[model samples]
Each structure stands twice: as C-alpha cells, then as structure tokens.
Target: MLNKIKKQGFLNRISSLIIVQVIFVFAALFLIIFNYSTEGSVSKQINEVGKYQTISNEISGYLEDNISSLTTDNLRYEYIEGELASYDEILKAEILTTDKDNKLTPIFSYINSVQSVTNEIPQTYIESIAEHMISEFNKSNLKSQFAPIIYNTNNIINLLPLKNNQKTEAVLVIVSNHDFIISNRSELSYAIFLLFLIATLFSLLTVYLIFNRFKWPLNKLIYGFKKTARGELYELMEPEGDVELRALTSAFNEMSKTLWENSTQLKKSNDELEESNYLLSESRSYFKTLIEQSPDSIVVTNFSGNITFYNDKAGKLFGYKKDEIIEQHIDKFFTQPVMNTINNTDNELNGVELLAKTLDEELIPVYCIASSIEDDKSNDIAFLFIIRDISESKDFQEMMIRVDRYYTRGEMAGDIAHEINNYLAVLSGNLELMPLFMKKGQNEKIVSKLELMRKTVDNIARFANGLMDPNQDEAVFEEADINQLIENVLAFLKPQNRFDGVQINTDLSTDLPLVEFDISQLQQLIINLVYNSAEAMQQIEKEKVINIYTQPGNEGDGTVRVIICDNGPGVQSDKKEILFKKRFTTKRKGHGIGLVTCQKIIEVHSGDIGYEYDEGAKFFFDIPLKQKSKEKISEEEKASTVYGN
Candidate 1:
C-alpha cells in the first residue's frame, strides 16, 4: 500500500490522508450525537412532568386547609376536580388506588385537541377542552410508564400518588402537551449540518495551503536533479524555504557544477595528452640526456672509501679518468667525515658535504651521500656514495660575510664624516673672522691666497658630507627620461680617469616612457658600474669597450629595462653565482659595495637586477614606470655598529 501511494506525487498522497482524517472525525461526531438524541429524548420528557406534580401537591394542601370547616369527603372531591379542570395545561386528571385492582378514576381534564407543537401552552388563560383520548393512550405501550411518559412528539402524562386522613391511598395522573425536545432536535439538525460544512471547508483549505508550501520547493529540486542527470547545466533560483529543502537544493547544484568542471578538465587533459604523444621519443631522449648530463656527479664507493663506479660527470668534476680513480681511496677526494658517515650504521646521510682533493691538488668542496647493501657473505655490506660539487654555494656564503664587513665599514665612515663636519663648520666661522681682523685685508696676494684656501675647505666639506650620506632610505623620486638619462651618465663618465681610454656604445630606445626613480642614487650606481668596468679592462690589452642598452619592458608592461655589457673576459664559472653579491670585487682598491649598492637602489624602486655570462658579462634590470611610493631612510639604516678599542 505504501509503495503504491509512493508512486503518486506529493500533493495527491498528502491530500488523500488529510481527507480521510476529516471524514473519520466527522463520522465519529455524528454517531455521538445520535446516541445522545435516542436516550436523552425519553429522559428529558419525564423530567418535564414537575409542573403537573406541583398541581397535585397544591390540591392536597387545599383539602387539608379547608378540612377545618367540617366539610364532607364528597365536598372535598368535588372542589378538587372542578378547581384543577380550570388550568389550561391539564389535559386530564384522575385519582387512582394501588390496590389489587390497580383501579383508576378520572377526576377532571382539559386536553388540547388542536395539537399545536409550535404554540405556547395556555397556563394563565383557559384552553378549549375536548374529549380526552384515553382509549388511544391506553392501547399504546405508554401504559407501562411508572412516572411521566412522553408519547410520540407532543404528548406528556404524569402519575402522582396521594394520601388522605381516612387511610385511603390514591394516585393523581395528569396528561398534557409539552414537546421542547422534539422541536429543539429539528433545529439542532440544521445546526449540525452547518457545522459540518464549515469544518469540511476549513480542512480542505488547510490541506491545500500545506501542500503548496511543500510542493513548489520539491518541484524545483526535482527539476534540477533531472536536468543534471541529462548532463545539462542550469542555474538554481535562490531558495527561501525550509532548511531541509534548501540543503537538498544546494547539494544538487554543487554536485552538478563539480561534475561539469571535471568533465571539461578531463577533455582538456585528453586533448593535451594526444597532441603531445608525437614527442614521446624526443622526451625520452631529453630525459636520458638530463640524467647523463646532470651537473651533480654520481659515484658509488664501497665501505673502504675506494671508488667503484661513477658517471662521466664524476670524471669532469674530480679531473680524473674512471680507470685512474678505480681503486683509489675516496679519502683522496673526501674529508674524514665522509668515511665516518659511510661506516656508522646509526647515521642518516643524504647529500652530506665534504672537502675533496682534485687531481690538480685543489681542495674542492663536494656533497656526498652513501648507502649500504648486504653482500653474499654474512654480516658484510657495501656502501654507495653520490657526490656533487657545491663550490658556488660556498662562494655565496663568503660573499655574504664580506657584505657584512662593508656595512660595518660604512657605519664607521659616517661617524668619521660627522666629526669632520663639526670641525669644518668651526673652521669656516673662524676663517670669516680672520679677514675682518686683518689690518691689510685688501692686499691682492692676501685676497687671492685666502680665496683659494676657502675654496679648498669647501671642497673637503662636500666630500665628507657625501660619504656621510649613504643611499640607505633617502628616497626622492622624480620623472626620468631613460634615453636621455643613460646618454648623459655615459658622457659624464667618459672623462673619468681610466674610462677616458675606453670606448662606449649606446643603444637607447627613443620610444621609451619616462619612469620615476631616485636620481642621485641611480647616478651613483651608473658611475660605480662604469668605473668598475674600466678598471677591469685596464689590466687586459684588448680593446676595452662598454655597451649600454635601454628599451621598453616586455609586453609593453609600463616598465623601463636597461642592460650594461662589457667586452672584457667574461666572469669565471667559480664566481658566476656570486657575481652581483655585496663586497666581492675584482679591483684591488675596491670597497666591493658597487654592485651591492646598485642592488639596494633598485630594490628601493621596487625593481629587480640580475647578471649572466655569455660572450661577455652582462648586467640587466627592469624598473616600473613610476616608483610605487617614495619614502626616505637615513644612511644609518644600511650600516651596523663597530666595536672600538
């Protein structure tokens, strides 16, 4: 039964249940009303006979009250029957004896022959009397009633017992028409019918409203599910419903979107895989070369530190042939820890570094890792060591140390400059007072020499102040024309010391935009770089030339790019990684802060700098068209404190 109903839609099933509930409730109420009407009708009629009972008691009291007159029993009986007959409601009255005969004698009666159910019974005024219908009432089953009896819909009769001083037992029986229950039942039937109509209407409206509230959200979710099953994408309207329905809706929408995205990605991957299949053999060859041509040499040594097997890269790194180093102790190329780490079973080794001796007797740095495997002999094992050279990494570490030293030096220079400035300021004030105090100050010789001395002091002060001011964070950005800026810097550099002999070339792009930069700091960077290039070229007899190039950045990205290349011997392989590092210079008298300062200046502008060695060494950088934000820091920012004696 449940399965069959489940096949139906939600509205149909719910409506069926609600309808059955309403009908069942109405039927139960109707049965209860019918039971009450059947029994209550008879009991209600019996209680209504209290009016006639009161009349019988009043006549007995009257007989007692007037008995003091010494009236005979005949007089009493006549007065009782005639006085009771005047009442309008009394249909008939009789005195009865409960002897073995159970006899009854009619006294007086006034019955309403008109038999009107809706009219009021005449209790105050007199009612028209007719022959009492005793034969019909006696023939019916109402004779078995012990008290008042209700016959059909309009008839009422009562039996009352009475006593007299003569020791006689008599009963009063009265019959009348009082039919409130039957008439009330008719009106009540109409009220019951109206109540049923209202209840049914309310039940139907409630079912409809509840069903629609559930139906719309359910229908939307069902439609969404169906669309997803068909591999079609659809947008879900924002739900304003119960929590459970919204959760179901959201889950379905998310599932559909995820599946669609997965399908698209899967198709994209398939296409890419198919197209790239043509290069499979090429890729395999490339991967093979990658292993063979690896920069890190592969070497395996036994537990005795003897060379067993190595790739070609190992030979290149150690400067020895495989045969030459076959039985040679690995200690020839590795330090003591290599032997200790390889033999220690408790050691964890993966690329542990050691100092190695090359064929030329050079102490080169190398990283080594070794593992062991058990041999055929019990408790015997062999070790394999993989060694790679890390000379560049060592060079970078040393360069950073030197950079730290530079910061220390700059800090000292600033302090010394500050002291010198104080002295120079006092001297300037003293010198001005000198001319005023001289007696013959206007003499040509004195004036010319004093003026020369003053100029000399001024120049010294400028140099001292310049040293005190490092380009740490005094950022003053302004628009710069790249094409013109490079040219002017080169022209100014052409006459500086050794650079006077070097040729300079420029490949400036005319279409480049004006970029914002710190002018004074960038000028210092250009001068230091060009001068360093010239100093390097002075040693070599080759034609020394410096080439400078400027262009718009790649993809018109609103940046200015610059390249400075030198035709001297390119950077050596050992120093390639640390070429632009701080405080690692080739010049004998160099402070080693030229390239470092250049990097710092570029960083302040939010740019990048790098160097590469090809036919010659080339340094390049790209700066944004405008400084991100201009903020200045003092020279103390770039320096650390120094300990004094």
Candidate 2:
C-alpha cells in the first residue's frame, strides 16, 4: 500500500485528498437538505389542514349565528352545499345531529371536488375521521371560544361544534386528502439529490483543470533537468502557476544558464591548454631530432660562450669525448675572433669560414653558422652553432660553386635572349609594315603598328633590367594576395604572341587569406609555368586551354594550394622524375633552368611543389600562411662562407 502511494503522481494524491473531503462535505450537506425538505413537506401539510379548519369554523359560525337556519334541514343543506363546495383540500363537508337513544344523523352534507364523484377514498375513512373530530370537539371545556379539532388519517378531517344557548348541537366537519402534501415532499427530495450531483461533476472538472495547470510545467522542468544530466544543458521556460512553482522555474533557468556558461569557458580553457602543450612537445621533439641526426656538428652554449650541449657529431669533429666537451669555452674550439664576431652581431652568422681546433692542438678548416635561440619573451636563452668540417672538400666545393654560378648565369642569359628575340621579331615585322601602311595613306594602321613596336621594345627593356639585376637572387617575403598575382601575370602574358590562341581559365577562391611569399618570385613562378604550358601546346591540334586554380589547403592545415594545368601533351613518363632537375628540358632551344628555379624558389619559402600528368601537365604547390622557423641551411648556401642567413 505504501509502495502504491509512493508510485502515484502528485496530482493523483491531491485529487484523492480533495475527493475524500468533497464526499464528506456533500454527505453532510445532503443530510441538511433532507432535513430541510422533510420540514418543508410537514409545514405544507399543516397549512393544508389549517385551510380545512378555516372552512369548518366558518360553517359552524354561520349555523350558530342563524339559529333559524339550523332549525330546518333545508336551510342547513343549502348553506353547506353552496359555501363549502369551493375548497379543494376539503373532501367533504357535513353537519351531524345526535337524537334520542344516542343515534347520529347527518343533517346536511356536501362533498368537495374529486371525492364527491369518485370512491377512491373509502366511505369508512371519512366516517371514522368525522367521529374522531366530533369526540375531540365535545371534550373541549370552553364552548364559547371553541376551536376546531383535527383528525389525521389517509385524509384529514376538521370538526367544529354548533351550539345555541349552551345546548349540544350539530357538529361541522371537513375532510381533506393527502395528494398535494405527498407529491410536494417527493419533488423536494429529488431536487436536492440533483443539485448534489451537479456540484460533484463541477468539482471533478475543476480538479482536472487544476491538475493540468501544475503537471505541464513540472513535466517540462523534469525533461529539462534530464537533458542537463546528460550534458545537454539548456534553460527552462517560466510558466504560469502558483507563485512558488513559478519561482522554482525561474531559479532552475538561472542555474542552468550559469552552469552552461561556466562549462563552455572551462572547455575552451582546456582546449587552448591542450593545443599549447601539443605544440610545445612537437617543437621539442623536432629540435631534438634535428640536433641529434644532423650531419653537421651541433653545439649549444650559454650567452657567456660556455658550452652546454654537445652532439655526437660535435665530439667526433673536435676529436674529444662527450665529457671533455661539456662546459668548455667556445674559444677553445674556434679562435677568439669567431666568438667575438658572433657575440657582437645581432644577425645570424651564415657559413662563416673559421679554423676549429682539435683536442690534440691541430687546426682544420670548417664552415660554421651561428644564431641565438630565444624564449617566448624574446630573451636570448642560448646560442646554437652548426659547424661543418671542410678540411678535405674545401677546394672541390669552391670549384662546384663557381661551376654552378656560371651555369645558372649562362642559362638565365639564354632564356633572356630567347624571350627578347621573340619580342624583337614582332618589332621587326611591325617596323617592316610601317612604311607600307604609310605609303597607302592609312594613318590608323600606321599609328597602330608604331604603337605595337614601341610597346614591345618597352617590354624587352623592362624585362632585361629586372632579370639582369643581381639583388633579385635574394627572395623578399611579404604578405601577398595569390589571386591578384595570378591576374597580374595573366595580364602581362596575354598581350604576348606566345599565348595568342590559348584560352586561360581562372577559378580562384575569393575567401583565400593572404599568404606570406615573395611577390616577385610568385609572379615569376606564374609566368614561367604559363610559358612552359604554352610552349608544350605549340603543336597540339586541340584548343589550347590552361586552367589556373587557387584555393585554401586541406582543412585546418593553415596553407593554400595553387594549380596550373594545360591541355597539352604532358611530359614523357620516363622523364617526369627529372622534370625539375637543372638543365633537363625537351625544348629545342630551352636551357631548362626555369622549372629548376621554380623548385628552388618554392623550397626557399618552405613550401613544396609537384608535377602530375592529368590530361595534361599539371603543376601544383602548397604554401603555408606563415613560414616555419629555419631548422637548417641549404647545401648551396653551406658551400662557402655566406652572411645574413
């Protein structure tokens, strides 16, 4: 029973209590109604009897006041019939006289309404009621102030004695039936019962409406709390109800909002912390691998030039054990001037030629690059030195550097001559046609030819000056819009005869963020790729279409990808692997330095380039939004002493 009660809902419990109370209240009310109904019915019956008594008294008074009328039976009969027939409750009216030998005689009689014609009431009932009323009348002691006597049976009878000068006389009697009294009591009982039934139905409907008012909002709050428990936090709706219930809902909404805000802030903090830790661990692992696995001797020292870290290569290069190298002054390995130069300068020392000493006091030629490693606050924490022994290969490296530089300059000059000769051919042809147009008196054609020749000459001069400049070798990194660069290259190239029949299509993503690159190198890269594609399609029969696309890199990698493809015969499969190598080209007059230079330019920017054959030659590259920290120097730069690394 207790379990069942506990399982019941709140509304069910409230309804049960209210229903029990209602039943008790209505039961008491029903009793009161029943008592009131009974009293009302009794009062009505009394009123009915009183009306009959009034009729009986009036008949007796009339007979007594007119003694002459009582002396004749005719006069008495006339009076009783005419005056007493009007009362409906009075079933019958009669005057009876007692003669000698005590026998009763009916002097005058009249029956009222239904009973006069019907025998529904037995004749004995009326006779018995009349006798009882007369006995009550005769037993009265005060005859002058005589009152009527009432005898009640299935009908009521009233008796009033008629007297003259203190002598016994006829008695006036009235009979009334019980029809109106019985029916009225029954109707009152039914009305009371019907009223009770209506009250009960109305009470039940009120309970239902009240229960729903509380149940709906409580149910919504319960569902909201359940969701919160499952980590899906949300606010609850404020509903209309009792004040206490509304207050509870308001409190829940406030608490939920607070909890959600705190949870979101905590989650964000955790994510940022985790990302920081991961980057730190990755950075540590990366530096550790580069220092330990690097072919050059890596040495780390404090700002005071005291060695703090020595790798395996460093120990072998200096001919010392690991214990012998720790805490040693860098001047013990290199000359004092080397330490002085590194400490006094703010810039990195790249490929600084110096003599390094061994444990046995012998000196050897070595190339060293030194830089300061700083903390997050930009405070210098340590100095890093990468030293490569050049004892055996110094002369060979110098020769190779000269050969490489000469070859590169020769290739650049060849490419320049090829580009210039194409423009010069256009200039020569226009110069040859200028006189003919002038002789024909076509000034418009002549002016157009002259303009073309002038533009071509100006383009050659600008191109030669930019390409021949020595400072162009060093890349200038800046924030550049990639799509704008492609557009600029296309604008410059489309006016040239090499791309006259070529259709160039560009699909650049508008939302691409700025990428850190060398603008001049990027423009040169585009021009070279476009020129290569145009040359590859010189003999293709199909429409020469080149597609250039720029878009963001893979999601969250913080890079951008660029693609340039042409509908031309792609490179031979056997030659694809060597496509970016120096002096490797299939063009009849090509020096093949363009693709190699493109590769080097991208490499210096810490980006990767690739080529693939997809219906044609497709060249693509991925460049980061920001360049990574330089971990090592390139072989070419390491060949001899170089500065400003």
Candidate 3:
C-alpha cells in the first residue's frame, strides 16, 4: 500500500492530511485530559475540606452539649478536662491536652505517643501550626489561659478554651495528619491519565481510516488526468467514498466522453485529407500522360522564356531532341529575332503568339498560347505553353487560292475562243476571194502568206479546244501507281525548254508501293516543284542537275517517298523557314503560291511535305499507300459521288 501510494504521488499528501488531523485530535484530547484532571483535583480538594469541616463541627457540638451539663465553673472545667482524657479514643485523634491558670498543668494530657497519628501528619505542617497557635494564645486577653493545640498528628490542628463562672479554666488542642488529606487526589489523577490515553488512540484510528478513504479516490482521479494529457485513452472513474468525491467522478466521466469524441473526429478528418491527396496525385499523372502523347508540339517554360519541358511531338517538329531544347532559352531556336508586336506596336510581346520558326529552319505555323503559373508560395514561377502546329491548315488555304485562280482563268479562256473563231471565219472568206482574182506569179506569194495564216489559225483553234473541253474538275483522291504518275507528270512538263536545259535524273524504285493521292493534283505538284528547281539553277554556271527519286520509306507503314533535289544555289538557310508561306517569294516575278499549293495537295491526301538544305536544296513528301477510313462521312463527298455517277 505504501509503494502504490508513492508511485501515484499521493503518499506525501495523504501523510500530511493524516498528520495534521492527528495533531489536532491529539491536542484536543490533551486539553480535555488536562482540564479534567485539574478540575477533578480541585473538586476533590473542596470535598475533602467540606468533610473535615463537618467532622470538626460535630466535635464542637459534642463538647458544647457535654460541657453544658456542668452546673458550675469548676464542674465545667472538670468535665472538659475529663473529655480531653479520652479525646483520642472518641475522635481517634493523635494528640490531646488540657491546661489551667496559665500554668503548665496537665489535667488530661494523654499524648498517646505510641498510638499517635504522627504518620498521618506532616512534620513541617505540625511545627508551623503549633507555632502559630502558640503565638495567638499567648496574645489572647481572655480570663482563661492561652494554649497551643494540634490534632491528627499535625495534619489538622485547632485550639479551644473552657471557662467557669467568668474565669478561664482550661484550653484544649487537637492536630491532623496531612498524608490522609491528599490520598483521594492521587487516585483521581491516575484515573484521568488512563482516560486520556484511551481517547488519543481512538482519535488516531478514526483519522487514519478517514484519510485512507479520501486518498483512494483522489489518487485515481489524478492518475486518470495524467494519462489523458499524454493522449492515452482511459476509462471513466466510478464514484467512491463521499458525496463530494462521487460528484467529481461523474464530471470527470463526462469530460472523458467529450475527449474521445473529439479524437474520433480528428482521425476521420485526417483520413479524408490523405484520400484527397491520393486522388490529386492520380489526376496529375493522367494529365501528364495526355500531354506527352498529343500530336502537336507542346512546350512549357519559365516566365523568362527558358524552356523547362517539351513533349515528343515538339522534339520532332523543331528537329531538336528533348534534351537539347530543355533548359535552353527560346531565343536559341528562333532564326530571326522574334519581334514583339501588339496593336501594330513592336514593344509588347509578352503574351501568346501564333507563327514561329524552329531551330532546323522549318516554318511551323502554330496556334500558341502562353499563361503564367504560380507556385504554392504565391511566387511567379513559370509560363505554360500549349502549341498546336497549324501548317496543314495554312496549306489548305493556299490550295483554295489555286482553285480560285483556275476558275477565273477558265472563264477568260471561253470568251477568247468565241472572239478568235469570228476573226478566223472572216479571214478565211477573204483568202478564198484573193485566190480567184490573183495572176499566176502572185499566186505563190499569196499562197505562202495564206499558209502562215492557216498555221496561226490552227494554233488558235487548238488552244481554244484545250480550254473549251470542260473536263477540269476537283481532284479526286485514290490509290495510284507512283511510278506511272511521275512519268505522266514529266511528259506533260517536257514541252517547256526549262526541263531540257536542266540536267534531269530519275531513280525510281521498281517495287515502290502505290500511294493514295489525287493524280491530277500530284501532277501539278511535280510541275510546280520542277519549274522552281529549273528557275533556281538557271544562273548557276556549273552542271545544274535536278534529281527526282521515288523509294519505299523505311517507316514500317508501307508508305512511298518522293524526293526532288536540285544542285543549284540552294535555298538560303535564313529564308527556308518561311519559304512555303503565302506570298513569301524571293524572285521579282515569283507569285509565291507554287510551293504552298504543292504543300496543300500533299496534306489533302493525308501526307506530309518538308524541305532540307544540306548539300543542296531538297523537297520531299510522303504519302501513305493504304487509305484510312474516316469514322464519319462528310456531306460533300456523298454529293459529289451522287452527281458524278
């Protein structure tokens, strides 16, 4: 029990309370015992004094009664003296004596030295009383003689004088023992001490039991509180001992209940937070996957235009690997100093821009958007760029321009045909009349002139027939033999001396797969590129060669490649980026729509077109041999097939 209390830190407090209570009870008991002993002693003394007074009064009455029986003075004296003779026998006195006439005459001086109560009287008390009585008697003025008296062997003492007929006859004396006077007081004191000891023991036992009862509950309450502070769950304490402790236990139980509820709530909140974080991480991973797999070039950079991230498409489009571009400044990739233009002003360029060039000098028409991103700390961290390559869209626009030009030229050719037919008919009629009216010698000269006129008419008629055929239509896309297409295109452009002056070479692969394309558009594309190559090489004094090659590309997808290369002053590295842009021409007479139109036709057939300037200018385009089915058919394709059939 002691060890347990010490472990609980309650031993000191319990001991202190017990000690204090014990001290209080002991003090009260001590005071009660002291007061009882003192009061009893005083009371016993008063009772003893009352008993002695009563006995003394009784003795005086006896003397008075017996002395009255004497008729004369001598007889009274004689009677008193006779009474003193047996005073020790009557009163059990220790001493008795009688005197007469101031003389030391003992009428009845029975000292009874052997039977005297000298043991009962204190010697000092007897001596002092004897001296006092003797002095008083010596000074008395009574006619009787004075005498000293002591009784009970000096414990009690008194003096008496007897008289007869107005003369003092004799004096009587008695003494008491002091030992017998205080015997009762000693017994009373011993009894009081025993009672005090009993009371003190009872008080200590009661205090110990009460302190133990209170300490048990208080210690449990303290221990429970300490555990709660350490975040350990503890059971509610039950009521014990007194009413006050029970009430405190009830309140503590309620507090424990509230704490348990709060702990459960906190755990639930923590779980929810952890789940949300997990979901957020998954979402981020999904978004990253989408960005990496997209077909368009995507780049992310800091606010200062330093590249931070790029996807696979971005690497291919810019001809730079991801490792090369990452962490590089955007300015390193652009061939020209990108002008910051906004509202026709060159100053503000901090936002999104559309068209841009790449490190490989390829013109990438992009739909670019840029926005600033901030980190959790609210610091301006980076810029996010979403770029979509719009090169195919630009090519489509150029195709529309060519189609419009063709429509206009076809309309003008019809009017020219009608005018030319009328003039020819009139000229023919006049020629017939001249032949009938001419002499022989003049006939040959007129004939010669007539032949030249016939030749001019024939050429005009052929030109009109070519324009009036009305066979031109929108190019149709289908699988075609590439080698056959190339031969047909070369034959068509062979009429122009432009092809004859250029050293032309062909390396057509025999096993090249037939690719899906528009044959008419493909022919036009070849014509445009060959014409451009011939023009570029016209000024070069060296052997100017134009090489056209066809081969199966290494792309496992069975697509055929067509390559056109020229050994002329190759396209200027600086100008290569915008070469195919609409109206971007380097020549004075150049319309700038030729290469753009070629790019458009290739794209319409689900193919790609690109240029390179290593060693010499080279233009290549790849068309997939197999057609890919669209998920949905368009209204235009349906209408065209219906009309044509």
Candidate 4:
C-alpha cells in the first residue's frame, strides 16, 4: 500500500484540487447568470404592471372629472365609451358607486371585447382602498389608492379610486390583456453560459498544458534522485521545460558526474580504510588488554546510563558476571545518589566519592571518574566511567582521621587534666571540711560542703564531655545556637596554655537563629579553624588577636554568616587557591585536613564557606538555618566524611 501511494505522481494530487476549483467556479457562474435572467424577467413584468397602473390612473382621473357628468343621463354612455376606446388593452371598465345602503353599483361600464372579469372584490379590500383614497387625495400616494394589481401571466386587473374633495366617491375597476416581453434575456443567459463553458475548457486546457510541460521532466528528475539515493548515480538529460526545470536537470547531471568521480576515489579510500581498520583492530585488542589488567575498574555506558561494556576489573569489583551486568542500568549497581549524579553529569566528572552495591548487596565506597565520548559532531554517543574500589582507602582514611583526632586530644590533654585536678581538689577539700563540720555539730557548713562537692563533680563531668572524640560520635543533625557553640569552644580553648597570651574577640549576634548541623562536625570544624589561626599567629612577633563574628544572613536566605578573622600573616596569594584542598596546610605540624574537613562539613550541611583578605585573614562561612530533609540523605553517606586526599 505504501509503495502504491509513493508511486502516485505529484500531478495526480494537484489535479484533484484543480478539479474542485473548476467545479466551484462553474457553479458560481451558473448561479450568477441564472439569477440575472430571472431578475430581468421580473423587472420586465413590473414595467408592464406600471404601464397598466398609468392607464388605470388615467381612467380614474377621467371618471372622477366626469363622474358628475357620467352620472347624468345625457353624457354617461358617451364619456365611458370614449374613454374605454382610448385604452385598447382594457377588456372591461366599470365606474362603481356606493348607494345609501353601502351597496356597490356600476354607474357606467365599457367593454372593449367580450371577456370574463371579477367585480367581486373582498369587502375588506374595498374598505381599505376607500380609506387609503381619502389619505392620499393630495399626497402623491397613488399606489395606496390602487387595488393590488392582480396578474395572471400577462393578464392584469386594477382597482383604483376616483376621489373628489379628499373623499373617495367611487372605485374604477379595469381588466386588461397585455403580453409582457423581455427581449433577448434567454439568449443573453445562453451566451453567458456558453462563454463560461468556453472559459472552463480553456482553464482546464491551460492546467493540462502546465502539468504536461513540467510533469515529464519532474518524473525523470525524481527517477534520477531515486537512483542517486540507491548509489546508482544515474545522469539525467536536460528536459524541455522552463529555465528552472532545465537548470535543475543540468545541476542533477553535474551532481551525478561528480558522484561518479567521487565513487572512483572512494574505492581507493576504502582500500586504505581497510588497512587502517586492521591497525585499529590491533589497537582495540591492545586497549582491551590494558583495560582488563588496569587496577581501576573500567565501565562504558551509552547515553541511557545502561552498561554497554565493562572490563574484568569492573566485574570483579561489583561481583557480577558478564551476563549479569551487561546492559543493566547504572542504578542497578550504584547507590541512588551516585546514580543521580551520573545521570545529571553532562561532560565529565572527576574524583566523586560514591557508594556502589555489589552483586551480593554489600555496598562499598568507590571513587568515580566519568566523561562523555562524543563523535565528530560533539554529540554524546556514549559515556566512559573509570571506577576504583576505595573501600580499603576509605578504611585507611578513617584510621588517619582517628589518629588526627587522637593527636588533637593529646594536645588538649594537659588542659583536661588541669581542669579535672582543680575539681578534684575542691572535692577533696569539701570532704575533709564536711567531716570537720559534722563533728562540731555545724549542720549548715556540712550542707554547704555537700553542695560544693556536687557542683565540683558536675563541672568535672562537663569538662570531660567537652573532651570527647568527635570521630566516635554518630552524624546527627540538630539545631544549635552559634553563640553558645562558640562560647563552649572558647571555654575549652581559653583554659588551655596554647592560648595563654592570645586574645580572641567575639562579636556574635544575639538574635542569630539556631542552625541545623552535626554538633560533632561543627565542633571539629571550629577547633580546626581556631587552632590553625592560633598556630599561624605563633610565628608573628606582634600581638596575636583572633576575631570571631556572627550575624544573620540576607533576609529570606535562612542562613547565618560567621567570620573568623585573625591578625596573623594572611595566606600568600599564590597558595590561597589551594588552602582548602586535601593535604594543603600552612602550619608546620598541620596535617592539612583541617580546612578540608571544615569544607566537607559545611558541604554536607548545604552551606558555603570562603576566605578573603582585608586587613587580616578572614574566613567566612554561611550555614543554612535548616538542613536538607533526611530522606534525601542516606545514613551511611551522612555518617561518613572524606577528610583526606
């Protein structure tokens, strides 16, 4: 069916439209000519009626003038006879008068020839005509006074009134025989129809001429185009048509010639391409081996994120056989968040740490790198993913974090011990004093000693709680006051000997809203930033001053901004860019994870942090008042933080 439809020529399609148009035009012309002929006949009949009306009016005027005369016995017959003789078409004429009883009587009648006539008018018409005669006596309303002209083909009857002094005295009835002639109307109509018929024929002939003029050439061109499409490259002869069609044929022939030449050259190129293909086949094997033996897993996917190819390392990493993994969507093996990232990535992804699930449903941390493989058109045809199982590396990172935390704790160990010893001393003193007071029967002193001892124990517990390792804590988000957290951090740090001469200024906003964050991570972030500042200031001979400021962020943003500025030598311009990168540190003993950890903490909270230099080194960060909903963040990902390179 499709082939049959395709075989239909363009002329066939257009011929239907041409036929419809011609039929419509012919119908319109027929209607116009027919209506004109009809109207002409109607107009001719109306003119005859008007002529009859004039004759009736003359008869009514004559009767009105001589009505008084015609009623007299001396001139009645003579006047009626003479008037009726003037109108040769009037078959009958009567002057009707009403008697005292309102009965109609013809005073005078003239018969031109013997013919049937109706004197029986409707009673209502008689009364209506009488009234109209009085109204139209001097107003040129002659039609109103005349009875409606009764026409039977060419026969007509006219009833008019003869009035005297604005009063209808009598009615004049006339029956006439006249043949209305509309000359040459049928001939004119026939002529019009004949002309239109000739026009239609000429139009169709022109259409046929135009169609034939182009049809043969176009069909030949279409054949050539089909041949070219099938690689036959048939040449077309210049067709006899208009300039455009001839030019099209010439161009087609030239194209066919060029293609034939190109075909010859293409054969040689194909031979070279075959040789190149052999080399490419060898290269493909080499790359395949390299990819298989590569330590990192390699997976290739199409635009749909479905796995198209994967090396043995990838199979091993995911615990999937070739049959199990091939053609599966990335989400089948990757965690949802990782799948989302992969789908959203357009060009390239580098060093993204994500979780992947193995065939046994065990999730392991992995580092991923991906890039789009595009063709010459820069369209992404496939995607290449380099996957590395980072489970062992993640374990090592956690260990290193523990070691870093332990080292930090070791640095604060003296302060913790000093705080504990002070509380212990107070308790010991209270214990001895309480015994002494009890022996002396001093109840108030004994109660005071017990209260003091309770307070000292509480202090010791609070200090110990502050010293707890953040690495061992679960990642739990909660609303906390910025000023309160800062005060707690300062309380622990100020009591330490490392800050003996260092002055830390605080300008925290009193009305700051509580922001959601992981408490342990926040504490760790503040500790790292503050310790780095203090340690940076150690080399400066000037007074070491660190200023911390907190304020509400821009309205409607639901964030609070905190700036920690220190009067130490700010970071060098050259090294500032990498200040927060992994393993980048400005401190001699710094592990470089401090700022990087701080950045990661802020990121997990959906916040932003940056550094700027004015008169001093200023580190500013914005924390959202609320964290992202828990459902969007998985427990494992939230619980883990990448701290090192």
Could you tell me every candidate's TM-score relative to the true structure?
0.30, 0.30, 0.43, 0.41
lDDT of 1 at 489: 62
| TM-score computed on alpha carbons, candidate 2 | 0.30
lDDT per residue as tens, model 2, 382-490: 8989999874463523333334334544545655566778898999898888888988999999988888888998877656434422334555678878887787667
Summarize candidate 1's per-residue lDDT along 9-38 as a digit string, tens digits: 445655775776677567647755665665
Over 4 Å off in model 1, which ranges? Answer: 1-298, 311-324, 332-532, 539-551, 554-559, 565-645
Lowest summed lDDT window (length 10), candidate 3 = 89-98
lDDT of 3 by residue, 92-171 (tens): 23222234443334334334443555445554554454445544544666533323232433344544444334333333
Q: Report the error of model 1 at residue 227, Å.
A: 76
In model 2, which range of ten residues has the least summed lDDT?
396-405
Task: Write down the RMSD of candidate 4 (Cα, Å).
Answer: 32.5
Number of the top lDDT candidate? 4
lDDT of each: 0.62, 0.71, 0.61, 0.72
What does candidate 1 score on TM?
0.30
Alpha-carbon runs more than 4 Å astray in model 2: 1-470, 629-645
Q: What's the CA error at residue 589 for candidate 3, in Å?
A: 12
Quote the lDDT for 132 in model 1: 26
How well is each residue in 216-323 modelled by candidate 4, as lDDT tens digits? Answer: 777878888988899896465665555567778888899998998898789889989999999999999888889999999998988888899988998888899988
User: How are the candidates ranked when ordered by lDDT, highest leading?
Assistant: 4, 2, 1, 3
